[model samples]
Target: MKTEHRIRVLMVAAENGALPAAKVGGMGDVLRDLAPELAKAQVQADQIMPAYGRFHRHPHASQLARLTVPFGGRHEIVTLYQLANPAHPESRLFLLDHPLFSNAGDGVIYHCNDPEPYASDASKFALFCAAVAVALCQRHLSRPEVLHLHDWHAALLTVLRAFDPRYQPLQALRCVYSIHNLAHQGTRPFRNSHSSFGRWFPELAASLTDAQTRRIEDPSYPQCLNPMRAAINLADKVHLVSPSYASEVLQPSDHRHGIWGGEGLEQDLNRRHQQGGLCGILNGLVYPDTPAPPQSFEALLNAMHTTLLGWQGHGTHLRNVDFIAHTRLQLWQQAKRPPPSMLLTTVARLTEQKVAILCHRLDNGDTVLETLLRRFKQRQPQGLYVCLGSGNHTIEAELQRVAAHHDNFLFLNGYQEQLSAQLYRQGQLFMMPSSFEPCGISQLMAMREGQPCLVHAVGGLRDTVVDNQTGYWFEGDSLEQQGLALLARFDELLEAFGSDDWQRVAANAKEQRFGWQSPCRLYRHSLYLE
Candidate 1:
């Protein structure tokens, strides 16, 4: 009897949540969940990422191979290590380690280079891509039918496959590039710098044809190379995270109108779409058979208080945000009445994309958030608004200022997984007014917990949320209009809270299901098999 063969796929990404302490954001979550689901469909999935100077230290990790890779005009030795994935024992997770992988610092997966963005990170990923290419050429890891790359961090492998003669064998494999975020394109000088393409692969850079250069060059800055654009152009398929986002990127972005589209690569993305090389598939979440029990309002407050104490740590002086959060938690605990009728919660990274609208100032010289707090206080004096996140110092300062002035507002300046989970379960409404979202996991998590959300109607939010049903969504043509629309929607939700209509919405939210089974089937047919 003949046995069937399982299709093999190798995923290269910057972050993988399957391994311990390897995640930073949604990309990590996707990498972690997608592998096991694909396995259920009889596809063998293998994963690789930079060790970030930590994974190799795992007790079960074993060194697989050591290779000398050609990078930045010299040979740099990198070691490949394999660790057993306890979560999915059938899958393989490989980590490539080198001193440069820890350029920012040991165990740091990302870095912010102030004067020049993506400088240090670009070099690190460039070396990593080169090492991955060499590993495949030397058969350190089994070749797969599909080579899956995630985000701009792993995009340089596509460039190496296209330009470098030594890595020409990689060209035979089908490449699928997933764009988690297009805002960061990883553009850098093509020549005359330590981190330049010419420095990394001198012969290949010098021999590139004008047409080949055009394919990889940054649309806005011709002198620079954009790995995102290169991947989009060279990969067999270009994938957007959500259906709505895929359509949005075909048009040029207009920031003046609060529109975030293709950032400057609309033409390139359009060509790919025309060629049938583009796809949009919504991300999925794992739904456990036994869902965790919902916490009571008082339990939520206690969790927040305990998490705040942990964040406060052994410092002699508590940070301003921590102090404010501590006081707010204490005040709520001391209250003798029932929990507030309205509990608003948000969990996100405080980047411009996530919180810019909340920080937008109205004509009356008050931030949208401040105005909302003041109005919410007027309607429900006992109401509370809690936000948990940390990013962008400027935004953090602005949020802290709002917390200081509003007695009913609590801003937890650090993230704790347990507390966030509680916030999702206990809150009456979840808020996510991102300027643009590529398929948000937070909204899905909140909805899974039966908490209705108030989100901006763009990207995945537009796809997942239903107005006046599962959740409330608002949209506008300008930033000010968007802010005002959010305020208007909040007022409407407040008026409808606790009504029979609102309860139905909550019930519908809980009934909505977004699992990995269907998405994995799409991956098998559309992304991997096709």
Candidate 2:
């Protein structure tokens, strides 16, 4: 294919096929949406991901090639698979398959042990980077004019391209590295693998002494030399998931809490930008069907209206207080362990960043549920607490136990795409107490579904949720405040559902359109493709 005939773009993503059959985090959602959208825009885009066992592969998928990827004085044979995009069957996708990396029991990628199947994860990715360069050099497939790297796992490709002469000839090819979440930088001890930089920078192994290696693995910012940071230093342009979030990282300003483990790294990031590197690219969701609210929201609203209004055909009144009350009651009844008179939904990872623990955890080390349950126990609590998604086994287990003990609480351990859409529609308000967020899609989807978001004012959350307008925005990092705010608004929302004010907010949220068309255009502009 002629270079000009197709806007050849290759996206290197770490979380694309992650969790296979299970929809895990936001990154996978991005990959799922982006490639197909870009293809629709006439951009010939393809994704490269590890062939995970969890992935349901298509039979016609072609095995592209086989090569031994060197890692820490050892070589692992990797098989490359090619398939047209299932989402947009016309678009292409490349899967890098390695027996050692993915051929574990269930074909999941978590095969780390001993020398760590992926222990040299950084090195493993380094091999992938080298392979990408080699592939580009050989011109065995489509020549990508833009190499898009997502998060830190793929950042190494930018570093390798900085020096790989084979790819240097494609000087027109611009490197775009996106910081999905700067906190999870892929940094580890650089084992002296022959096919690795040890062959080029022999002193690399010496530099990473025992002490230094240990420090890098530390979760602390000082101990980490994130490859994402290195990519920022090398790539022509660095992008964040959202414009507002882009602004947040520029200043953590004590407001960011919980989820922000690598706090000061943004300071260093700003310094790098001063030298001319970083930029913000707001994350966008694909509106594949109808560009309308998911059916789940409509169904939930109908039930609420019918229960509260008594005279309802459909809750035509924008903010019908009675309708909201009815809705809450219905939801409460459906909740496994309903609360006294209110039901709140929080669907996110059960981590501190997600504020799952903070909101649910009690001073006695039990959970907020115990406190709420205790208060409502005498009243046969009308409220329900439903949690969807998984993280931190301890947190997940605790949440499950709470659900089991309390009829008001319901815990869904894994992610369900349709269920997520339903939650956005059915839930009165979406809660995200993340210490810091890089433009969360859940909140955006909630708003679009006419469900208000009650989020902490940090990163993307700060940018999207308008305080008192769209939903609620808490300034502090405290989950207690978040839970309180939801409770405080509960009665008002129910009493004045048809109120013009609340309706305006829901309408505004519904109108807030985020699609890949504009973002893809930005990519074209950034790369000067037009």
Measured by lDDT, the strongest candidate is 1
**Residue 8, model 1: Cα distance from true site in angstroms:** 0.8
Per-prediction TM-score to the true structure, in the order listed: 0.96, 0.76
Q: Over 4 Å off in model 2, which ranges?
A: 1-6, 17-23, 40-42, 53-57, 103-124, 163-172, 191-225, 252-262, 288-343, 356-380, 477-504, 527-530
Supply the global lDDT for candidate 1.
0.89
Model 1: CA > 4 A from native:
1-5, 313-317, 334-338
Please report, in order, the local distance difference test score of every candidate based on alpha carbons. Answer: 0.89, 0.61
The residue-level lDDT of candidate 2 at 427 comes to 67
- Per-residue lDDT of candidate 1, residues 1-530 (tens digit): 87546889999999988876687778888999988898887778899999998888888889999989988778999999987665587888999999999987778888854467787889899999999999999999999989999999999999999888899999999999999988889999899777788887888899999999999999888999999999999999999989999999998888877888999999999999999999999999888788897567878878888898887685788898898888878777787557886899999988888988999998999999999998899988989899999888899999999998998889999778788889988888999999888888999999999999999999999889998889999999888999999999999888988999999999999889989898888887889867
Worst 10 residues of 1 by lDDT: 111-120
Candidate topping TM-score: 1
In model 1, the Cα lDDT at residue 363 comes to 92
Judged by lDDT against the true structure, how good is candidate 2?
0.61
Clash total of candidate 2: 23
Candidate 1: Cα lDDT at 106: 78
Query: Model 1: which residue pairs collide?
Result: none
Ten consecutive residues with minimal summed lDDT in candidate 2?
Answer: 109-118
